[model samples]
Target: MAEFIEHNLQGVDSAILAVPVALAEGIVWEDLARMVKDEKMAGNPIAGLIDKLHFEKNCMIEVVLALSAHANSQRWYELKKSQERKQGKTFTPHKKAFKLAEKKIHLQLSQV
Candidate 1:
């Protein structure tokens, strides 16, 4: 995870900053998924960012941490479990199905 993040710094930072704004604007993970798949993300913030980073789960988890959502990785695991329980699904998140599980945390050490 650290290695991946180290390799993809620029894209990751974009994801971190862009995602929060998106969520504030009412964009959902599902919407991000559709945008990514359809490649119709023109005018969408994360569009054209694809080539900058490749989506990976560890990086996504790190993004969650950076957002101060969970305090620590253990809490993150708990959140993951709770989310799985609520959704009745497994690693849709870990597989990058969800994109931050769709902010596309594709977010860095030099991260903002």
Candidate 2:
């Protein structure tokens, strides 16, 4: 998990910072299933688990979006300032899902 986090630094950092509680437990299927389930049952759990997984996935998406937006906004400000000062404009946010996530995050941040 730590290796995965190091490999995906941006996502891991945001995830760690944003969902600290959830991260503490780690991303386990059964735990997540239980979290989203309406109740624990002895029989037929996949449907509930899947539904819960979807919900949890959406929640994580929201968190990712918000974190990306905040980081992007800060970086944008610093980059612009540096460009103005002729110091440098070296940082370039890559084209990836992280960029799209920032849009959702920006909206969330606005509400906050």
Candidate 3:
């Protein structure tokens, strides 16, 4: 999953899932626009909802600033080195770079 994000969803179903989800369930843009025009949506529900989604999705912060290959090659190795030094444990091939990016993004969004 992490690699997919870093590399972009080339053939993943997520790319398709994001569309309707973001437009309908995620943002509810049409209803939101109606509410805003009619003054029914108080305090900007659309903006609030978008902020919430971005927070949940973690589009704000990123852990590794590189492509999938770079992340796998250099960043992962560096992370392993740090882990070895800090915790004296062997580096496990578990963490995914895209997942790390998502985590960082979520953390920053939550702070906001």
Would you list the C-alpha lDDT of every candidate in the order shown? 0.50, 0.45, 0.42
Question: What is the TM-score of each predicted model, taking all chains together?
Answer: 0.38, 0.21, 0.22
Tens-place lDDT digits, model 3, residues 1-112:
2453345433223323333455656566455345434442455322222211223332212322123333434554576677778664333333465578889999999999
Segments in model 2 whose C-alpha atoms lie over 4 Å from true places: 1-19, 26-29, 39-62, 65-112
Report clash pairs, candidate 2. Answer: 65-105, 66-105
- Tens digit of per-residue lDDT, candidate 1, span 1-112: 3344445556556666665566579877667546555563455434444433223442243455154322333455666778779676555556666655345344433355
Winner on lDDT between 2 and 3 is 2
Ten consecutive residues with minimal summed lDDT in candidate 2? Answer: 44-53
Clashing pairs in 3: 2-98, 58-105
Which residue pairs of candidate 1 clash?
Answer: 12-107, 98-101, 98-102, 99-102, 99-104
Give the TM-score comparing model 3 with the true structure, all chains together. Answer: 0.22
| Model 2 residue 58 distance off true place after TM-score fit, in angstroms | 9.7
Candidate 1 root-mean-square deviation in Å: 21.4
**Residue 53 shift from truth in candidate 2, angstroms:** 4.8
Please report how far candidate 1 places residue 11 from its true position, in Å: 0.9
Give the number of the best model, judged by TM-score: 1
Candidates 1 and 3: which is better by lDDT? 1
What C-alpha lDDT does candidate 3 achieve relative to the native structure?
0.42
